[model samples]
Target: MKIAMVCLLSCCAAALCISRFAIPEAAAKGSHSHSLGYRCPMHPAVLQDGEGTCPICGMKLVPVTASGPASDGSLAVTPDQQKTLGIAVARVERAASSRMLRLPGRVTPDETRVYRINAGVEGSFRDVAAVTTGSHVRKDQVLGSYYAPAAVNTIQLFLLNTAGYDRAAKKKSEGSLDGENVDLISSNLQQRLIQFENLGVSKRQRNEMQRTRRIPDTIEVVSPVDGFVLARNASPGFKFERGMELFRIADLRRVWVTADVFPQDAPYVRAGMPALVVAPEESSTLSGRVAEALPQFDSQSRTLKLRIEVDNPGFVLRPDMFVDVQLSAELPEALTVPTDAIADTGLRRTVFVETAPGLFAPRNVETGFRNGDRVAIVRGLSQGERIATSGVFFLDSETRMKAPASGATASLTSSPDPTGRRTSGGGAGPFQKSSGDMQAEEAAAHTSAAALR
Candidate 1:
């Protein structure tokens, strides 16, 4: 009887131990199995309890792990995952900034240095040098000679006046002519000399005429300045009327480059701003400055015209030649970041800021000026903040997935229901799941809670 009592007690103790541990262990295992949920890796919006392919993207669904979202709606990504996604980060800082503007330009002669050769009287070229357009000529170099009938008459009148003045001076010296009469004759002679000089007679030629008291057959046409001929209308025995152009010359020691700047960039460009001109075909670079900004934009191209002056020592820069112009404008100190960091959604601009290691949050930003590769942050950001420079697209997509209420995420918060009425507050947004999907999510939520417990 003693042995039977001992055996029964042992059996009862063993049964109590099994009830306390084995039953709860089995229940917990069952709950964990029911708590598992599947989600598409690419399309996180697609969630379901059973494992299958995503209906939208056709990607294989993976089990959704029990990872909780951050309290501030920030998304946490692992270092390994960030590496796989190619995320790059940069720090925002205040510093001196500048922008480079590249524009097409054309080389032209300086307007102030261009000269047109014309005779003041009717004439015809008796003989012209073999010079044509682009021929170099020096100062006072004889380009051709012309015969003007008008010039001959003026010279004869000047000689007659000179004779009368001499006779008056002789009489005044002999005390026969009065001072007033001699002065009047001298004045008339001066007027005749002026008329003769106006007839294209140089000072040397006038002196020679006064000494010889005769008229030359032809007046020599000479270049007034050293330059290259831009146009030549003179030929042997070619007749030209008064005030007609014979040649066009330009001193090409300095040249102007006309650059067409976009209307939006016109504000930054001003006179005296430094610029660099490049000739691709010549493989040459020349420094220049903005000479002037045209008052109006082009009527056809709608671009503001800028005149840049540069020196051409070897005549390398020719008229009508195309070149590239680079203009640099200094910007005031402001918070700036790489241009790739900002994600523009048409309605708003957002940037993914790395709040902590492996954590990124979306921040709205007001952009001011956007230069190539960098942009100025006018507001909604501060210096010393780290932002994602590249792979922002993935962060943006994740932000929308994790935080639908984040205003700058650009995810719509409302959609029309079956009744054609729009509802606010996360009601079937672009990425939101349907009612049927909500049922699956509900089941997954229960499973997640069970797993957590």
Candidate 2:
């Protein structure tokens, strides 16, 4: 009888102590913090004007009081996690911000400088011993020769005219070809010589043909620009028509650095923007300006074309050579933070703001000018706030995994999906099935054996 009585008295005493002291202290804490109502200390999302237990974890309500401005989605990190995740923080401040853009590009021939060498006249190719693909050619150097009927006729006519002119001049001591002192034969001879020169017959060659009185059948097609032979189409004895492409020449003294830019960044790129291009194998850097942004984009690469005109003084940059390009721009004054702080998704940008010691919360933000490691904050943040700069990605992922889902209401109803599939735990979980269902599906065949038996 005495043991039962003692046990009952002890239990009553313990209950009274908890109710009068511990509960009041917790209530006072909640009241002092919020100054209006009570809230759960562990889950601040649960708020009430009166004291109550947390709905998520059933923890006792603590008093909510003024703790300063902070994001509601703030989460606390333990010391171990901070070390493991390499979390780093910096204070947000106003400073001069500049934007430096880095782009990967390649050295390409300037469209205007890539000269397509075509046969000047129609004839068969001759003495093409030195002409070959990848040949370095000088200005006015013959690549190869080709035979064309009209070209042969012009050269032969030029030789005949010049030879006839010389003989006429010899006879012109007696007067003109028409036997007049006015000498209209000189004018006619000059016209014939100009026509022959229009056929790309050099003065020296014409002179040689005239002196030898030879009716040249084949003429040499020469390069107008000093460059490397990009392509060769002519071969000895091959009959090619006039205006046919015989060689493709490109001057490497200057080239174009075509940078591939994403469409989102296309607005800042414009003509005359200063740029620098550096090749991986080359020692010196080439400076240039944005010539133009090609209207068409590469279908497979889906990148906007930005052309930079670069001077290759020593022939250091070659066509198709990969290069790194940097473009810098200035921006208006604005609040900024480290670029590493921003968490980027395709549709939205977020940052982890340090609310309290070891507590970081995600805040949706708009970003502006980006320069190196710094990014301008257009919205959702203020100066004098602290933000997690490095390791924000890991912190964001950890917060989603560890923090309780806010505004989660309990629902037992099996929500139907678009396909009429029953989705438990309401329709807002994810766009996909839970892991439990996936596991059960994977194990369903093993359970079927019991039904068969």
Which lDDT tens digits does candidate 1 get at residues 75-109? 66667656755778878889886788999999999
Off by over 4 Å in 1: 1-51, 61-73, 78-90, 164-190, 193-198, 281-283, 292-296, 345-348, 355-358, 402-453
List of clashing residue pairs for candidate 1: 35-447
Candidate 2 C-alpha lDDT tens digits along 259-365: 88878677667789889887778667889999855645888999987888988887888878899999886656778888788888778888988888888888899
Give the best candidate by TM-score: 1
> After best superposition, candidate 2 residue 70: deviation in angstroms?
9.9
Candidate 1, run of 10 with poorest lDDT: 15-24
Give all candidates' CA lDDT scores.
0.72, 0.65
How many residue pairs of model 1 clash at the backbone?
1
Off by over 4 Å in 2: 1-96, 147-149, 160-194, 292-296, 339-364, 381-453
